[model samples]
Target: MISQAAYGAEPNKDRRIPVTVLTGFLGAGKTTLLNAVLSETSSGKIAVIVNEFGEAGLDHDLIESVEDEIILMQSGCLCCSIRGDLAGTIADLIERRDDGFLRFERIIIETTGLADPAPILQTLLIDPELARTTRMDGLVTVVDAANGSKTLDAQFEAVSQVAMADLILLSKTDLISAKVTDALSMRLNGLNPTARIERPVAGQFDPKQLWGLSGLRKGVRQEDAIAWTTSAPEPKIDPLANLSGLSKPKPVSFAPTPHDTRISSASIVLDTPIKDSAFDYWLDTLIALKGPDILRVKGIVFLEGIDVPFVFHGVQHIFDPPVPLKNWIGDDRRSRIVVIARDLTRPELQRSLDMLRAHQPKTGTKEEVLLGHD
Candidate 1:
């Protein structure tokens, strides 16, 4: 049987419409990112789906179609969904486009502040009906730089949203110190090593960086995949060096502690290549025991016999098949895996991993590798 995802495809152009799910906590600058994309002149014919028109209200020249929910803007973009469930709404939009009523090159679904992105992602990835017509481009999560740390600690939804994103936009950086921003960036990176964190100055960013990120497409470059799986940069200390204890009467810092943590990240870089079966077994055992606690797992693995490195992605218990790259990108060929979880300390997770034959031979059975807030 022909797969539904391959049926009635458009000619010349790729038939699958790329959809970006935009999510963030309340006042995390999601609306700001949306406005930036909408206002940018170089953007394509993008279709936007928001939960409330009032929340995303912006002044743009209107085209002919101005329904209660769906409004076509003069910038070759369409705004949709006054209020409804996401799955049904997206299906309706696809139907309209198929029927020649709507035209757009891509789609962006701006989710509510309190939304858990996993379900939205599940629909995009596995829903056969929608999967046929549309492909999930990537998730762009907006994070408030000034208040992000506290928000992540308090709200599980915010953590999950950040954990699952393909790209994270750090907004309102100007409102906070570079040290604070650096600290927040490190925390986010620990939570999700697979995502690229970008700072948007005054809600302005290049639209091209936000879209075309679905790893399944033919147009998806190997460079993008490598970039996604690469480790995050360490936070700089020099930015915070000016705050002296004697001069400033000692500054108070809420910087992360070794185990004060409910949610934390662990990234392991293996000096030697791992056997495929051994690596698989390690992951299976880890997830089976703590699937509910594990929020996200992503990495580039270098297998013993394989010439190419494969990228692995997992959300809770569900794991996507590893994607093999055409060639290694740079000089660094070591295998790196990052895990973000709740109530699991980096040391405990590392101990479990140290037991794996991939890194074993047991040098005291302790977790030597640490990631996030290092």
Candidate 2:
């Protein structure tokens, strides 16, 4: 959990609102899940910004019809459309909220079905005012269990959505068999090993599950931190000779799909603390050369001469400022970094780490030899 101090001061001192980006492909039950969230009275006042108001099936009784663009829900929530500019829309909401015209605890942005989440995530990090006033809580993606495999096989966008998700809600599970749903879950795990996958009951889930999902915040548990930055090891393949050949079994061929080969998810662990210069140089070079292909990079870094470790997060080229875990305890000092990239292989990423290791500051001076005097 991120304490109020994580935002730099007390809650009253820092009014940075947390924003959650909700996204999914067409017919993935995004609307159903969103409606469930809004209908739940236990969920605090939430301001929802949708790409299109006409398409969002918000309850009529809840909407007070404030204006052409804004609809005030009886539950004390606000609903608005993008009106062409996301940043401008959010800025207006902030102004109104400050002026006592609106009330909401957090903001949720729902993107179009075909939307790519990378650009939306970049906007939050790149916009100065947005970055100052709002912090990204996390990204929640809805996947249709019945059609997930077909969608992934047909649309790379759907695959990308699965890859960049922090929380994946498997919707429409009731429409499919358990065997099929389990297969989809395994595929999702392969696409993104870090994301938490849940099969929401009847397309409904607790709103609280969406909050504080970054896992890079202060006061977070060490296990949670490790889970967020560590990738599961690839399954080992055994030799065919080990199998029983009493009946002369048929030969098996192994092949990976194009999508699987395109996106690579891997992690590297370093035993020693990294020098400041070396870490910066390696990150800068990697982002400069492969920013577009890079989807997400997150890590817990322990720098030389620094007592507390810094948690860093990045989406492509844009990155949030590293926050120090002042209260972090334990003697485990290994640095761990996870990267999800497109068209980048594990060996390539390893080579980049090798560069960082090669550039590390040399330690200990050797004593001068007295061979000449002897």
RMSD of each: 5.6, 9.2
Q: Please, what is the whole-model Cα lDDT of each candidate in the order they appear? A: 0.70, 0.76
Full-model lDDT, candidate 1: 0.70
TM-scores for every predicted model: 0.77, 0.85
Best by the lDDT measure: 2
lDDT of 2 by residue, 1-374 (tens): 11223334323233578899999999898878777777666778988999887778777866666775788777677789897689989999998889988888899999988899988888887889998889887999999989988888888888889889998888987886565676677677778887888888963478789887886565666777777777543222223333453454333332346876677876766666777767887889999999898889888888877776778889898888776666668888778777788888777776776675575444421111110100
Please provide, for model 1 over 1-374, each residue's C-alpha lDDT reduced to its tens digit, 9 standing for 90 to 100.
01122223224445778889999999998776776677665767888998887787656544446875678777768888735567788888878888998878888988889998767766765767876777667888999999998888778788878877888988998998777787787777666766778887874478888976545343346666656555555443333434652343223356553333566677666756676667877887888889887877777677766665666667677665455654455655666676777778666687666645345444422233445432
| Candidate 1: regions farther than 4 A off | 1-15, 60-64, 82-84, 176-183, 186-194, 212-223, 235-253, 257-260, 271-276, 302-306, 327-333, 355-374
| Clash tally for model 2 | 0
How many clashes in each structure? 0, 0
